[model samples]
Target: MVEFGSPVPEVVEALAAGFVSRELLDWGGVALRLTGVRAVDQPEFGSGRVRWRTATPVVMKGSGRDESGALGPRQAWLLPTEPEWPAYMQGNLRRKAETLGLDPGVELEAVNWIGPKRSFSVGNGLKPGAPVEVELSGPPETLRALWSWGLGQANSGGFGWVSA
Candidate 1:
């Protein structure tokens, strides 16, 4: 089932209200009629070790420092196999947690790609990724928010959608 979610309680409430009203969600030349509105309470993901599978690819990136010192993609997409994935995931989680006013203590323990790498055209370039099963550890609040939020970068762009 398609789901729209957020780590913030107010946003969740707003989404529920919109769904109840059968709102039309439109963005970037895409629109979906939000039907089958139901309030599903957040899953009870207790603290400690947890496993989450990405419904969408968990996206990451490497720094691109050109001769002019600009940031783009040194290497288009950062796959889970890359040596930099762990640190990037950690930092990304910290950023998300801090942004949501949650404690930034989530740790990335493991990630296993579950599907072939796929590419999608985004704006002027292509985004390469693959679905991943991730292992993580943190406090209950942080873990809940992580589940509510997602696994990696580009979550706002629909890339890191995950499930417990």
Candidate 2:
């Protein structure tokens, strides 16, 4: 029962992919199945608090039932698609630690995505509005790649990455 708490199409897609679960509370939808959840804490809006750590990425799955009471094939979206991308889990701290010649392999307990506030427009000046502030935590390079991947995926409506 991963709580997505977001409705962004890509995020929703990720949720649908079993990466996260969109808590469509306002939509009057609830998952009666009641399962487990892998929660990743994100900021309210536009907070640069990144929390990337080397851990198992959450997996998603289909859970029929939506806020509108729509029942069909659906899934929870998990993040960090592959288990090989370790940098996204450990942000600057790990990188900096490694750069400084320190043991980056050391574990850091607090790491999650950093959400942003004041979302202007999505793709091609399309406004999807803004939900809550989300915190995305990952190494600079990995985070950038994620943004690029997400945008590309969103723009193409197929598959790709988005970055800043």
Please report, in order, the local distance difference test score of every candidate based on alpha carbons. Answer: 0.77, 0.33
In the range 1-164, model 1's lDDT, one tens digit per residue, is: 46777888799899787677866767667887766776567776665678888888877886544446577645546777766677888899888888888878878887755666877777788888778898888877888888888877777778888864
Candidate 2: 10-residue stretch with minimal lDDT: 53-62
Cα displacement (Å) at residue 78, model 1: 0.8
Poorest 10 consecutive residues of model 1 by lDDT?
64-73
Residue range 1-164, candidate 2, lDDT tens digits: 22333323366456555633533323236534434455343333233234332111222122334556576664322233323223333443354345444444433343244232222243454222111112454344433333322311132332221111
Steric clashes per prediction: 0, 44
Model 2: lDDT of residue 2: 24
**Judged by lDDT against the true structure, how good is candidate 1?**
0.77
